[model samples]
Target: MKTKKFQGIVQVQYEQARQSIQTGDLLFCSGTYLISELIKKASNSFMSHVAFLFEWNGRVLVFESVESAGVRIIPLSHYVTNYNNTGRKYKGALYLARHETLIDSSFDRTLLQNMIGKAIGSLNRNYDQTELIRILTRISLGVGRHKENEAYICSEFVDQCFRQIGIRFPRTEAGFVYPEHIAADPHVYPMFEIVP
Candidate 1:
């Protein structure tokens, strides 16, 4: 019952958040897990996770890589409906942004879906622990690169999609590209900021 009520209270906020996102837009989140704290420390940014939104047959889905699930596509409802890991719902803290330079027309729908398909297909793969550590280390010293691995970290997965069209993210040589880095670009416009 407690979980049900908690879900009810946050459901409205989730809906509001969903409305703010559009197809081809990017979403950044401030998570409550302990690792989130470390990610914030490593990246020196508020956001710990990022995902892109996709509208399919009237349902909004978010594609992201998570430590628990690696690279996967989830419905927007599943992404935001539940209370955060800390069991608290904060308002206006999470945000979604779109790159001003990212025009939807530049992408071929079939090719993009194929890319997403590749991610969906890679579900059997695991999250890249080595890459995660490399990201943290590189973020601190601003040097070194993660060796190629089959696993997926959130930022690397998202960045790969954008890289498909020849868009260089973060405009940096940093070893690990971060979610905050993507959302920080002047070209990325904030779509919604809800204060609950």
Candidate 2:
């Protein structure tokens, strides 16, 4: 249970037992502003259509709009287009905008904790423990990397393969640092962090 501190505000450290976290455990983390940059980057593409789709039981689900600004998920149908392209030009095309329900600090930590709890709870029913942990890790690392100050946000989409199966969440010192810790600086904005 050794914990590491970051940004003088938030600190999260995983247990050594978690090092071997199987492909069935769930990892949950959250942040803000990263999703906006993703949309901005996607808009630059010449003929790319990005949409977020939640898949369950072989069916595809697309998000209409993200609660927060600048985050979107690309539809799977877009991948069917130009199937002959082998370079995976469509890879990493979709994005998830960070969603923040709070505008100010009026809500207590319980509210924030509950938000995360609900997300995890929802995920648990849909996926196995390992898959749950992998997705959470993917998002945590994705958000951790883009923490900065310019008000610009970026979206980091976890691959569908990784989403369905289980992947390891990196257990590095840098991986544990929260986005808000680094985002405190005004000059260091619009970046991405990958854990693992």
For candidate 1, lDDT tens digit of each residue in 1-196?
0111111122235566666566667867777678887887777767778878878887888788888877777776654444334334532245666766555565555555655665566665777878887776687767678565677778778777766545556734645678777767666666665334
Off by over 4 Å in 2: 1-53, 56-70, 82-168, 176-196
| Residue pairs with clashing backbones, model 1 | 91-196, 92-194, 92-195
Clashes of each: 3, 24
- Identify the leading candidate in terms of lDDT: 1
Worst 10 residues of 2 by lDDT: 152-161
Q: What is the lDDT of residue 54 in candidate 1?
A: 79
What value does the lDDT take at residue 69 in candidate 1? 74
Instruction: Report the error of model 2 at residue 67, Å.
Output: 18
For all candidates in order, the CA lDDT equals 0.65, 0.26
> What is candidate 2's lDDT per residue for 102-164, written digit by digit as tens?
222452434433323323333312212232233345554543222222121111122221222
Each model's TM-score? Answer: 0.75, 0.21
